[model samples]
Target: MIEAVSLTKRYGNTVAVDNLSFSVKPGKVTGFLGPNGAGKSTTMRMALGLDNPTSGQIRIDGKIYQDLKYPLRKVGALVDPRWVHPNRSARAHLAWMARSNRIQAKRIDEVLDAVGLTAVAGKRVGGFSLGMSQRLGIASALLGDPEILMFDEPVNGLDPEGILWIRNLMHRLADEGRTVFVSSHLLSEMALTASELVVIGRGKLISQSTTDEFVARASDDAVRVRSPHLQRLRGALTDAGATVHEVDDAIIVSGMDSANIGETAAAHNVVLHELSPQQGSLEQAFMQITGDSVQYHSDLDEAPGQVLASGTN
Candidate 1:
């Protein structure tokens, strides 16, 4: 397991990570989520001892990373996929890493096969596509047969098939009783792939919970209604204390499920041309949770208004 306790990091006046604390358990996938410049990479770097923290500490199995007798054998990471020699073949790259770490040379072929790079292992890395390079990076990280693996933006450049492959690979690793800690900006993918999440904003911890709990807190499955008889529906819904909102030329009744919305519409003698549940997307939930810590803001203030029966744009 990996534990981060009150971890903080600062570079001059900029606080990259602020008292962030979380743990990544074995045999599961924990997603690290944040916007650009939100310090996801910085937190990861500190965890690996690539950078020192301003205060606090992190440990892999209750020991400082720097003190690990066989660090590579305990933890493997792919922070930067660009840290590769273009001239080297995929097999040669992992072989060099193994040699440096005193790892047996035979394991190089094992990782190459594990990452599905055995076919291209002899090809020069410079000839690889972005997806191939990413696979090569994964192969390099697994060269030591580490139990804990950390991937930073693993799907940054890939086709749909490649993304699916990586997603399955993460789950496969966890199924093998290995710990998989990954960071990604893809909310939809994360929603489907991650078992748990550690959400942060502007270097501060915003949330740490399982995917189901996070969704429960943010997802509001409300039925949206649209009709020419907006006033009547508004009045009836407001009388019934159902939350409503005004769209372009329609009324949206929320706070109730589809069945209740339909029943209310029929009871109030209201006509509706369109009535569909406004299933909140993961992106909306993410935005709502981290709104205050957003580093970039737009001039237009389009805050989603909430109300009972009627709301203005």
Candidate 2:
């Protein structure tokens, strides 16, 4: 397990991470989520011992990262995919890392094949495409055969197939009882990939819970009601303290579940053509929850013509 207690980091007068505490358990994929400038990078750096925390501590299975004798064997991370020597062959790069960590030389081939880079193992990293580079980075992370893996923007430069590959790989790792912690800006992918979430904002811990719970808490639960007596049903729902809105031939009802709506419809003797529960999406939840935490705000609501006119005045 990875645990942080009051972990904080400071740069000059600014605080990058502030009293953050969270635990990532094994056997599940945990997603790290936050807006840009939320100190997620700093936290990951501290976990990898790239930067020291100003106060508090982050530990891997109760031990600090620097204190681990063979850190790579316990924690494998791909924080920066471009950290490789451009002129070095993919095989050579893995060999170097393996040597540094006292890993067996033969392990290099295993990782190369695992990442689908065995064919390009002899090619210099400088000539590799972004997707290939990402694959190499993943291969490096898996070189140690570690029990814990950390990836930052792992699908940054990949086609659909590559993205699906990484997602499935993470799932496979977690299924093998390994700890998989991934950080990405892609909420849609994260929704499908991660079962648990570690959400932060402005360097502080906002929430840590199952992905479903986080989404449910952040977004409203609504039920879509379709009936020939739409107006009557709308009145019934509104009288029951539910907010009803119309869209096409259906009425969207909030503040009530399908069960309650069904019972109400039965009591009102209303004929229902369709009644389905609406699910909230991760993107909607993230935007609603992290709106205030965003460091930079864009005024996209302002029309271009309005802005031009106001500027001229």
Candidate 3:
């Protein structure tokens, strides 16, 4: 497991990470989420001891990263895929990492094949595309078969196929009882990939919970009711202490479930065409929770199609 106890970091006058604390357990995929400039990268850096914390501490299995007998064997990370030397071949790069950690050279081929880079093992990293570079970085991370793994935007430049590959790979690693912590801006993908979430904003911890719990807490219990007797049903629902709103000919009832709405309508002799519960999506919940923390905003009032046409000569 990985634990952060009030981890903090500063760069001169600016605070990069602020007293953040969280734990990552084995056999689960934990997604680290935040908006741009949210200090996610800095927190990950502190976890790996790449940057010393201004105050507080982070421990990997009860030991500081710098004190590990073989750090790579205990924790593997892919914070920046571009950290490799441009002039080195993918095979050479892994070989160097293996040598530094006193890992066997035979593990190089195993990891290369594990990440689907065997065919391009001899190719120079400078010539590799972003997706290929990401694969190579993952291969390097797996070189030691560590018990803990961390990745930052592992699917950044990947196509659909590559994205699916990385997602499955993370799941497999976690199933093998490794601690997997990943950070990404893709909320939809994170929803599908992560079992737990650690959310932060502006260098502070916002939430730490299971994926389902986080979504449920951020969402309101709402039911969608459609009926010809819109007026009567609305009155009955409101009288029952439910908030009602109309949207596109449908009545949205909150503070109640579908079963309650149906029963309420039946007792009032109001016919119902449809009654469905509307659970908030991860994307919707994320937007609601991080609305104020978003550092970037777009001012375009029109749709993208309209904006593009207006800009055309």
By lDDT, the candidates rank as 2, 3, 1
What local distance difference test score does each model get?
A: 0.85, 0.92, 0.90
lDDT of 1 by residue, 15-72 (tens): 9899989899989999998866788999889889999999999888898889988788
**Candidate 1 TM-score over all chains jointly:** 0.84
How do the residues 1-313 of candidate 3 rate in per-residue lDDT, one tens digit apiece? 9899998888999777888999999999999998777889988888888899999998999998999988889999999999999999999999989999999999999999998999999989999999999999899889899999999999988999999999999999999999999999898999989999999887888999999989998888888889999999999889999999998989999998888998999998998898888878788888889888766555457555343331210
Tell me, by lDDT, which candidate is best.
Answer: 2
What's the number of clashes in each of the models? Answer: 1, 0, 0
How many backbone clashes can be found in candidate 2?
A: 0
lDDT of 2 by residue, 48-97 (tens): 99999999999999999999998889999999888899999999999989
Error of 1 at 73 (Å): 1.4
RMSD of each: 6.7, 3.7, 4.1
lDDT score at residue 71, model 2, on the 0-100 scale: 88
Stretch of 10 with least lDDT, candidate 2: 304-313
Q: What does the lDDT read for residue 204 in candidate 1? A: 87
TM-scores, all models, native as reference: 0.84, 0.94, 0.91
Displacement of residue 5 (Cα, Å) in model 3 is 0.6
